[model samples]
Target: MEINMFFLVLLILIPTFVLIIQNKRPKSNLPPTPPSLPIIGHLHLLKEPLHKTLHNMSHNFGPVMLLRFGVRKVVVLTSPSAVEECFTKTNDVVVANRPQLMQAKHLNYNYTTMGAAPYGTLWHALRRVAATELLSATRLDTTTNLREHEVKLMCRQIYNDSSHKVNFKSWFRDLTNNITTMAIIGKRYYGDEINMGDLKEAVEFREMMEEFFIVMHTETLGDFIPVIRWIGFDGVEKKMIDLI
Candidate 1:
């Protein structure tokens, strides 16, 4: 009975001692930050349109400001001089690896693509292949006729609709899409599938791509709390998979 009571007392005392020790530790050694609350950290202090908030904070904290988003520490570089230093002086060290994302993991052909690949032999090989096969002068020359034909078609469409007030935005988007499709797949897919819409399946796919980008660019707690990623708090991984 005594041993049981002692064990329970030790369990409670050990955690309390650790907490006291942690509290006594000097916070001056840590990086500067805006005052924040517990659990949520600086999250509540952030204003809407986070980029703007960061920009505002930079005026007080200098060009390089440290921000805590949830449990993560992020360094924001706001000045062009600082950005130039990162790109020119510390280019290799600064741009070492791409951040792993759910979409890249599940849908980027296992990260075999150049966009998602790390800076290594495989990435170099993919870059070389893309440069030679897709961006080469020979390839561009071969596709020149297709590009011209598509542009001519676009001109005709604009001429036919000259009298009407048309949406130049949609028209330009369709033209761009048509040109890309003809160049890449050797076919135009605009306005083909009825179920997809009067616009082609490719246009629908473009809309989906836009939505995926919007979500990825938005801030989320998982990005800050690494452990929360294990629980899949935002269903980010699943949404990424569905988008792909």
Candidate 2:
């Protein structure tokens, strides 16, 4: 009877202790949040057509509401004025840092790429290089003929194939890929009539690019939840690491 009473008292005390600790903690100044579950927060409310769902939520929570996606806190700003405020001189530097995503770490050489890098000395240097060399007006004008030639080639190919059904989407994708690769590497990797000598290399490069796009865009659960990463519960994280 004494043992049974002791167990009953322990259970009662545990909840009371938790409640007391919670009541004593200081409340945060976060904006109004929708009701959330204990571990998952507001994840369950994220339905398909995410933009529409967020828009609807903004109606109730206001433009500057905060949300917890797994463990990460997100601030949703719907109004144009609120968005402008974040990019102003005062707030721009504060908000310029990109979230250190798993893909950026593995594929982008640990956020060293200009697109992935945080706004810092390295980014400034990269911007200077791009301005004077890669994207300068003189450099662009030099490449004008290359762009025109590629467009003419594509148009001729399309015209020749007018009798058959043409996939404009595939053609457009090829056109853009060829133009980008030519600009960056001095050779086009996509489309027919590629040099037979470089056919094997081109095929390999295309495969690599396709895989890169797939891995870059795919979401990993580890990005959102720390425990998922620590416990090795997210297989997508492993795939990302392997791809890199």
Top candidate by TM-score = 2
Query: lDDT (0-100) at residue 158 of candidate 2?
Result: 93
Instruction: List the global CA lDDT of all models.
Output: 0.71, 0.84
Residue lDDT tens for model 2, 1-244: 9978975886577556646765698998988788764445588899989999989999999988888776677888898999999999999998998988888999999999898999999999988998999898999998899899899989999999999999999999999998898888888788886889889999999888888898899877678766567668757767777776
User: Model 1: how far is 68 from its true place, Å?
Assistant: 2.8
Candidate 1 lDDT for residue 224: 62
Pairs of residues at least 3 apart in sequence or in different chains that clash in candidate 1:
191-200
Q: Best-fitting candidate, measured by lDDT?
A: 2
lDDT of 2 at 51: 93
- Residue-level lDDT of model 1, residues 165-192, one tens digit each, is 9787877787787788777766666633
For every model in order, what is the number of clashing pairs? 1, 0
TM-scores of the models, in the given order?
Answer: 0.72, 0.83
Candidate 1 local accuracy as lDDT?
0.71
Show the lowest summed lDDT stretch of 10 residues, model 2.
14-23
How far out, in Å, is residue 142 in model 2? 3.1
For model 2 the TM-score comes to 0.83
